[model samples]
Target: MNASKFGAEYALSDDMAEFPAGHTGAFEVPYPRSCCCSSGDADLLEAARTMREALQEVWLVMDALGAYQSDDDRLSILHSPKFSSAAYRVRTAMIKTQRVAI
Candidate 1:
């Protein structure tokens, strides 16, 4: 996965700290335009919500994995029941999200 693609979602604001030295100007990130919700398209809204929840779950699991600093720690997490449960949910959510997206 491209880190830059995800970073595109983040925009530096006046409330945010200044960028480091040598930073130039800001460029507009390529954001996908949202669909019209007033059209009464329930399927689209459902798919969007599912995708968002799945992504959030994946993000949490990723943060948990980040706590493991060594191979042993990683192995322990790999064997954890919580890890397995999260993995299943993420996989299922991804499959559902993809189907609806198409």
Candidate 2:
């Protein structure tokens, strides 16, 4: 399911929207505008990329959890290997339908 299905309940609410056109060198889906680059160090830039990707990872996990909660089984995720793995992990963790011996 698309992330927008969650509406305005996102964690990074302000930074959630796409960067304004011309704000970055290019208006791309994965734009370079997400980073501040205070030191301009190569390692710092790499860290920013990793952090952004991690945020995306958690977003997909939340999305999958929402879909499963709504009982929408048709929401299929074909891309994003890490997201696919993380989604099921989050889905199973959040769901309380598992059997218990109590």
List the lowest-lDDT window of 10 residues for candidate 2. 93-102
| Candidate 1 error regions (>4 Å) | 1-35, 38-40
Point out where model 2 deviates above 4 Å: 1-40, 67-102
lDDT of each: 0.67, 0.51
Residues 1-102, model 2: lDDT tens digits: 234865644343455346564453334576466646544455455554555665667776667657445444333343446567665655544342232111
Question: For candidate 1, what is the lDDT?
Answer: 0.67
Shift in Å, residue 73, candidate 1: 1.6
State every prediction's TM-score relative to the real structure: 0.48, 0.30
True-vs-predicted CA distance for residue 97, candidate 1, Å: 2.7
Total colliding residue pairs, candidate 2? 0
Candidate 2 residue pairs in backbone clash:
none
| Deviation in Å, model 2, residue 55 alpha carbon | 1.1
Q: For residues 1-102, what per-residue lDDT tens digits would candidate 1 score against the true structure?
A: 233955555555664456664453547688765866545566667777776776776676667678546778777877888677677877776776676533
